[model samples]
Target chain A: SAVISQKPSRDICQRGTSLTIQCQVDSQVTMMFWYRQQPGQSLTLIATANQGSEATYESGFVIDKFPISRPNLTFSTLTVSNMSPEDSSIYLCSVDTPPAGVYNEQFFGPGTRLTVL
Target chain B: GIQVEQSPPDLILQEGANSTLRCNFSDSVNNLQWFHQNPWGQLINLFYIPSGTKQNGRLSATTVATERYSLLYISSSQTTDSGVYFCAPTPKAAGNKLTFGGGTRVLVKP
Candidate 1:
């Protein structure tokens, strides 16, 4: 398993503001994905961050609202723009490695807990 | 789009007991995984069983791809196992994208 970390484990932000959460991995990975888990709900895919390309967002989500940046193979950043109370949730980052030696499983970070007021 | 379902939305078990968690998918998949989200809210990957069976210490999982269902067995459960268990499925057609289930909340009392 790869070690992943997210900065500012928990944060409280005001409405109309923005916060960028950073995800770093110990080793290079092929694919990185961002997900959100609202209170008392299941996880939802936000976007897939690919190096040197615009992130692929799922339906009901837009780049203008949640912008993603992947500058390198082991680091990525997701910015929640113009936050609202409805955006309060846990943001998680996942990575997929080569499935050669073992069943390549998606490794998740300790997630960033964001609260909008 | 694939649909994922997990059974026993809420469960209360005693320490040293055994329990089974079920995951059913609406479509065939090449990838099926189980995750445990502890009280701390950290998602820990438990298994990557797309088909057949695999075991890890006190936990084991089996996925019947043709049947579009999977099973997670916890042997000799501990208080630490109290948390939400999630099952995610990824269709082979999709490039490793996972759709997660609603999850089953387990509470193991000592």
Candidate 2:
């Protein structure tokens, strides 16, 4: 429903470093989100980036660890702070495209694969 | 926060065969989605069927919201269809928060 793109399709970083994953949508969306997929696990919501405001992080996820930025309706960034091997996973950005007169549905990006050593 | 469950954690199929993937939710959901994550880890949205039925190409999905379950049907499966299938559901008021199931891994052999 929406064309989404993420930068740095992949990265290999040393522990203690941080990486910022960027997500850009072709058009404006009502909502944007960041999700993390750990090894052998399902996708987990990291946070919801609110345009021009602070993000709302999910349980067990802290803003200090996974900071999010939604500068505008079409762009957002998620930074994995103080990286560790446990932080290695696929980070995905998604946007919602609501049906006309109906509820919204989410579409995801290709994902940014991050491997921390 | 809702609990999502998927059946048959893994499935092996022959090319040109057909398969059905199931997703069940613990509570009512205002929005239901099915996704196919390719080997490269790109998540492809297969269906956004909050209710009723929707189809695209050889893939179709049916969501019986009243029953709290959804089914994804793949007709004439191909090698490309081999991947992780995930089901995510969110309440209408939850905004963009989605609770994803563990996912079903599918392997197709030609």
The TM-score that candidate 1 achieves is 0.97
Window of ten residues with lowest summed lDDT in model 2 chain A: A96-105
Relative to the unseen true structure, what is the Cα RMSD of model 1?
1.6
* Model 1 chain A weakest 10-residue run by lDDT: A96-105
How would you class the docking of model 2? medium
lDDT of 2 by residue, B1-110 (tens): 67889988999999999999999998878788899999999888888888999999999999999889999999999999999999998865675478899999999999
Question: lDDT tens string, model 2, A1-117?
Answer: 789999989999999999998999998887888999998899998888889999988889998899899999889999999999999999998887854223577889999999999
Question: Which stretches of model 2 miss by more than 4 angstroms?
Answer: A98-102
> lDDT for every model?
0.92, 0.90
**On a 0 to 100 scale, what is the lDDT of residue A116 in model 2?**
97
- State every prediction's TM-score relative to the real structure: 0.97, 0.95
What are the DockQ scores of the candidates, in order?
0.61, 0.72
